[model samples]
Target: MRVRGDDLVKDLKKLRKGRGILTSSIISHVGPALGEADCPLSDRELEILRMVEEDRTATDIAYALHLSAGTVRNYISSAMTKLDARNRAHAVRIARDQGWI
Candidate 1:
């Protein structure tokens, strides 16, 4: 079975957290590296934004991602709010500029 990158990352984080002292030591050394790797937007937000960058409609993106169109729109709206974008196009542009997608 194929696990998504987001799921794998979350699983690794869970495993690291279970290690207590080791995780703390690693976090101390890792510092900003971990912070930088953490996306300001959630995985679903990034995925939908990237699709927008490809000029896909909300319906198209929803179909591709196996989500409802409304759900996809909500994610896009949330991403726009987080990025302070004027619209979906602007959000995609900002995300691309930040290398978020």
Candidate 2:
């Protein structure tokens, strides 16, 4: 593309102006990532809670996820600690309330 010198400056300014506009749609599209910015749980811990939401036992989740039941329990314990939850059920509820699972 070729343009007169004046047209080149005009096009450059237009592009810069467009880049400056951060629309709500853009933010909403990026909401999931930004939402977790303050989240204290690890990704693995979050994954465990999500499975916990499905009423899956640690052994069941471990079998499906190929992790040990002990590992799954560890993740749940960590998530509970981070969320200040009293137990597995509370952890799942807190995670759901925070939109983390």
Candidate 3:
């Protein structure tokens, strides 16, 4: 399904008001956890994380980096495992909190 530009902007605004804005408590919670976790992101993983930080989707990242979507997914999965994250969003949070992304 194609998302209209206006609708996308509206959704982003809603997200910013809700979960997208990172508050102090969220930063505090994620900070300490990062130092204690085992490092799981390889060079490729780091790249994927950076792209995700820029709001790129898996397909976008794969296409930009000339990698397969499966490979990008694997990198994300490995990063999540290493960071002990529950999901991709969580992993990005951890990575950002640690200044790893």
TM-scores for all predictions: 0.61, 0.62, 0.61
lDDT of residue 54 for candidate 2: 93
Residues 1-101, candidate 2, lDDT per residue (tens digit)? Answer: 12366754554565578843322222223335567435678888988888998999999999999999999999999877766577899878766755767
lDDT digits (tens) for residues 1-47 of candidate 3: 23456755565576678855432233345436655433446878888
List candidate 3 segments past 4 Å from native: 1-39
Clashing pairs in 2: none
* Sliding window of 10 residues with minimal summed lDDT for model 1: 20-29
- 39-95: candidate 1 lDDT, tens digit per residue: 468988998888898899999998998999999999999987776567888777766
lDDT of 3 at 100: 74
Q: lDDT for each of the candidates? A: 0.71, 0.70, 0.71
Task: State which candidate, 2 or 3, has the greater lDDT.
Answer: 3
Instruction: Give per-model CA RMSD.
Output: 12.0, 15.4, 11.9
